[model samples]
Target: MIVAILGAGPAGMSCANACLSFGLKPVVIERGDHLGGAQRSNFHPNLWMLGFPGETGEQMTTRLAAHYRELPVTTHYRAEVTRVAASGDGFLLTLAGAEGVRTLSVQAIVLATGTRPRATPALERFAAECPRAIIGPLSDSIRDDIRDTDVLILGGGDNALDHALFLAERGNRAVVCTRARFSARKPFIATCRARGDIELREHCARPELGHGNERVTAAWANEQRAFDWLLVMYGYLPNTDVLAAFDPAIRPALSAGGYLHVDAWQRSGVPGIYAAGDITDTPQPSVPTAMAQGLTAARAAERDLVKS
Candidate 1:
């Protein structure tokens, strides 16, 4: 049976691998020039470490792509699936690519479109004027050029603390502005406080950008003040556009935040549709969780297909 996978990231690749192992034909479509989804190099530098020191995101994606190449799945890079519709006991997917639009009829569909970083309202405003204003996931924009600049980070989460520590280690004056009355985690807060180069400001809003025709010059939190680069560590939002063509019964199962609702088997409300990775309503959106979900989805799909 032909199975269409909506992404070529870790989750999609994992699902495709499982499908191929089950003797099913798999088609992997990716919107970007390469796979890895958000794990691409454009994200924050400190990410992909999984709190351990090892391979980078780019390295991991490269390995994933290499592994997939050895599999029987057909991968279409820079291909975007614009529409999905039920057709003749199967499904039809209309894809737009660099060459032209193509259509694929598959028996099963896997939604693994992944997610995009959610920018804070404060940071969005800052970015509107100052081109240098950067967000956590997009931290690579300033990674190489952050040597001597004073960096202002907003949020007290792990992402915020990590970026602050990274900037401090790079010899830049790093300060964290948190809305929480206290740091979210004591250990992280303590470690950041212990770093003389990193300053912590609690119960604060994003500072106002100093007026300049170029980058941000200064920031103000209430009466406190600071300067230079601004990085906001907020989070992410799932990309569910690929599932838009699904029936309404399937759509409502998605969480308020747009994450697909899935059972332990990763089956959504639709019988032949499955979801995996950060696009699900799973409590944890980690890489391991995505991989496990992908495996489960593929196995469930195989089982269901056999029973039918």
Candidate 2:
């Protein structure tokens, strides 16, 4: 049975690998010019992925990408899955990419659409004016340009601290300001506390921004503080937009945080459809979960196709 995987992250790649393992044809669609999803730009090292010792998130993903290319999988890079719908005994997908607008039907679908950075009013208001002035958890987007630049990052999560460390390591003055105390891992919190270039601030009501050609001329903390860029790590929002076009009757379940509600095997409870990775409802998001979910979902879908 032909299956469509809508992503190229660990989960999506894992799904493709498993599908190939079971002699199932798989098509992978990725909207980005590159594969690997958010992991590509994450600066922190991933400790879970076996065999690749001390590999950072991006490095791990790089290896996975190379492995994926070697497998028997059809790939559509720069392709967007604009729409999705349930067909007779399968699913129909609309795409807008190198082939323009076209649709394909598949026996099963695995949504590893991953996640997008949560938008904030402060960043949105000036995003277009200063595209380089701000970035999200994918901190590398502005790392090269931000060297020796004063940058303010907002958030209290582990990724927030990760960004702070990343920026400081790159010679940028990193200031992490949060509205409340940190909710990150203990080690991350301790590291941030011990940092020199990175300064941690708490109890901030919210960042008050002043306009500049590069997004912010000043931010109000106790006084007027200016920075070249405002990096925000407010958290992530799932990219399940393709599901919106699905029939209402068969729409996949969503969690309070907007991730898909998948079973242990990664079924979306909407036969022929499944979810994995950051898009799934898990208390904490991780790379291992994404890969395992993809493997499990693909295996389960293989069984379903056989039974059919």
Best by TM-score: 2
lDDT of 2 at 12: 93
Scored by CA lDDT, what does every candidate get?
0.75, 0.82
Residues 15-49, candidate 2, lDDT per residue (tens digit)? 99999888789899998888888889765778667
Q: What is the TM-score of candidate 1?
A: 0.88
lDDT of 1 at 274: 87
Q: What are the TM-scores, per candidate, against the unseen true structure?
A: 0.88, 0.92
Q: On a 0 to 100 scale, what is the lDDT of residue 169 in model 2?
A: 81
lDDT of 1 by residue, 107-152 (tens): 8888898887668676677677676677654445458677877777
Colliding residue pairs in candidate 1: none
Residue-level error in angstroms, candidate 1, position 69: 2.7
